[model samples]
Target chain A: MSRLELRHMRKAFGGLEVLADISLRVDAGEFVSILGPSGAGKSTLFQLLTGAEHGEGEMFFDGAPLDDHGRHFAFMPQRDALMPWRRILDNTTLGLEVQGLGRKAARTRVAPLFAEFGLAGFERHFPAQLSGGMRQRAALLRTVVQERDMLLLDEPFGALDALTRAAMQRWLEQMWRHHRWTALLITHDVREAVFLSDRIYVLSARPARVVREIQVPLPRPRDPTSAATRQAGVLEAEILDILLNLQPTKGHDHD
Target chain B: MASSSFNPRQLAGFLAQAAPAVISIGLVLVAWELYANHSGIKPTVLPAPSRVFEQAMLNRDALLDNAIPTIRATLIGFACSLSAAFALSMLVDFFQPLRRALFPVFIVSQTLPLVAIAPLVVLWFGFGLTPKIMLVALVTFFPMLVALVQGYEATEVEIGQMLRAMGAGRWRVFILARLPSALPYFFAGLRISITYAVVGAIFAEYAGAAKGLGIYMLNAKNNFRPDLVLAAVGVSAALTLVLFGLTVVLQRLAMPWERAAGRRAARKGPQA
Candidate 1:
């Protein structure tokens, strides 16, 4: 189990700041989500968290400062980013292979997860042969195989169709319940944040700062037909209202 | 997968596809022979196709002797060029400053005329196999080098970033992503370079050689035997065709995914 804390994180590119005073926390075995406007520098926050880009911040894991970011967290970027030349099995084993694992051993470990990930018969198929949903599932498998303490998922379902995205969200929650790895998801989908997360962080537009943090009291297995689902809807509306109210101030900030 | 017998329908379809080109060549040959016999043109100027074939058959032993040196020189030179280009491209890709400094030099080297340089190479290296090999390597290196470097550069940036996020190093990113992505470009360069290899070898030999098709052509030209010269030309053309076909086969074997994707595209319109 691992806990992550970010305190007063700030990042800029050249003269333009993208993340301003953004702070959040993820307790051990918790699922947290970040919701924001379309161009609110959510990706910059991810880059900072993963050490892909540098930022000014205090980041702690398990009560100790994290000098390095990527070593302890598995990251899934917005795009599936599967290597077209590699087979699905090989692609799924990429993270492990990067960590100095042998090819044969990595293959052995990843070969069984194909069926769990809904990719049983496609071990030999290339990325171009799979549909978008399958590619995302393969990418997810690649991320999970690394066995990191935390997972950084950046808009993992942003490109999926609505129906497929909803299905994948349910499937993801089931996997999260089983594995219970600490996860921080960056997304603009309020309903997705409300449905999957134990807590949600909402950010304002560019040079984003955390405007609100909401605890979701909804129960697990949040079936859309349950009272919990109705509660999620109310919470989504409240978050939407906060974002709508923030828009005028966001425009003035830009000025 | 190995079968002694082919599907008869498949065989018939292939024959049907090739029939027109075969017929056209046959007709041109017959017409050339007839015109040459009727018009009483000098064989030294434009030998009839039948006379050229007969000359080739009569001097088969002599033709084979010279063909050996040309073939040897061409294969050795092409192999050298391919290795050099691959090493140079990989080095340039690994070192950013080297790319800026060396790529322009490679491009500039290609603009020099082979005709002017071939003789100078022969003068420096003498009438041995060294000059012929050097000429061939010089002429065929550029296309492959450009293709390989551009292929390396064209690696999908998002994939590289994702790998980096997963803790992959610079060399690991190159091995797992850039190398595989560059294969198609490498084959494209190979096809372009192959057509030049034989011609470069012949030019090298033309400048100076103890034995080769180029020397045979020169001897025939001096003796005023245009038929023999045409026969040597025919042999070199055949050699080029064989090499080109080999590269295509290599491409097919190296990229089975491309073939599968192509078949899928054909079945379902274009992939988005």
Candidate 2:
């Protein structure tokens, strides 16, 4: 079990500030979501979390200052980002391979999870052969197989069709329950945040600050049409109202 | 499409595609024969195709002996150059400063005339296999090295980032991402280099060689046997065609995706 905490995270690119004093926390085994409008510097925040880009912030994992960014977290970029030349099994084993696992051992480790990820027959297939949904599953498998302290997902399901995205979100929720791993997802999809996260942090546009923190009062095993899901929807609407109000004012301020 | 069976329609289509080139070549040969018969020029100056063919048949033993050395030199030189180019490209890919330093040198080296250098090589190395191999290696190295460097650069940025995010080291990223991506480009360069390999071998031999098509041509020209010279030329062309075909076959075997992609594109038609 791993809990993640960020304090007063600030980022700037040249003179254009992207993130400003953003703070958030995720308890052990909890799923948290960052929902913001497009170009709200969510990617910038992810880059900071993954140590791809440096930002002025204090990050802690389970009460320890998060150092050695390489080993601590698994990062899934916005795209599937699987190696096109590799077979699905090989791609899935990449994280393990990077961690100095031998070919035979990595293969042994990942072979069983292919079926669990709905990719059993596709172990030998290349990335291009799979659908968008399957590719994301493989990408997720590649991320999760590493068994890192936390998973950072950047728009993992944003590219999928609505139905596929819904199914993947459900699948992800099921996996989350099974593993109980801490996950921080960056997304622009309010419904997705409402459906999958225990808490959602809504950010304003550029120089993004956490404007609202909404605890999802809805219970688990949320059906798409159930009262709990509707309650989550009400929360989603409330967040949407905040965003709609902020956009015009934010646009005027930018100019 | 079955490998075991021959379809008549397919055979007809193949013949139809080949007919135009065959007919044009036949016409050229006929015209040359007519000119040779009527112009009253010495056969030594401009031997007809028939005489060249006859000379080739008559001198088969000597031609084969000479042809073997030329083929051997070309193959050896090409292999050496391929290995060297691959190593250099990998180095350039690994070291950022090396690319900055080496790319200009690579471009400059390509501009050096083989004619001016071949004699100097022959002078330095003597009339043995060494000069011939060096010339071929020099001529074949540039295209493949450039192709490989460009291919390395062409690796998808997102994929590389993803690998890095997974905690891959520089060498691992290259082995996993860059090398495989560079293959198609390497083969493209191989096609150019393979053609140059034969020509380079013959030119080096021309400067001075004990045996090979270059030596055979020199002897034939000195003996005023234009037909024999043309026959040697024919053999060199055949060797080049054979090597080029081999490269194509090897490329197809190595990159099945290229063929599959082509078929997929054909099926999908054009995209807007």
Q: Pick the candidate with the highest lDDT.
A: 1
Q: Which digits, one per residue and each the tens of the lDDT, describe model 1 over residues A1-255?
A: 338999999998999988999888999899999999998999888787777888898888888998677688899988898888888999999999999999999999999999889999989988888777888999999999999988999999999889888988988998898988899999999889998999999998888999999999999877888877777888989999888777856345532
Question: Model 1: how far is B97 from its true place, Å?
Answer: 0.8
Report how far residue A221 has shifted in candidate 2, in Å.
2.8
What DockQ class does candidate 1 belong to? acceptable
Best by DockQ: 1
* Candidate 1 second chain TM: 0.91
How close to the true structure is residue B134 of candidate 2, measured as C-alpha lDDT?
Answer: 93
Worst 10 residues of 1 chain A by lDDT: A246-255
Give lDDT per model, in order.
Answer: 0.89, 0.88
- Clashing residue pairs in candidate 1 (N, C-alpha, C atoms within 3 angstroms): none
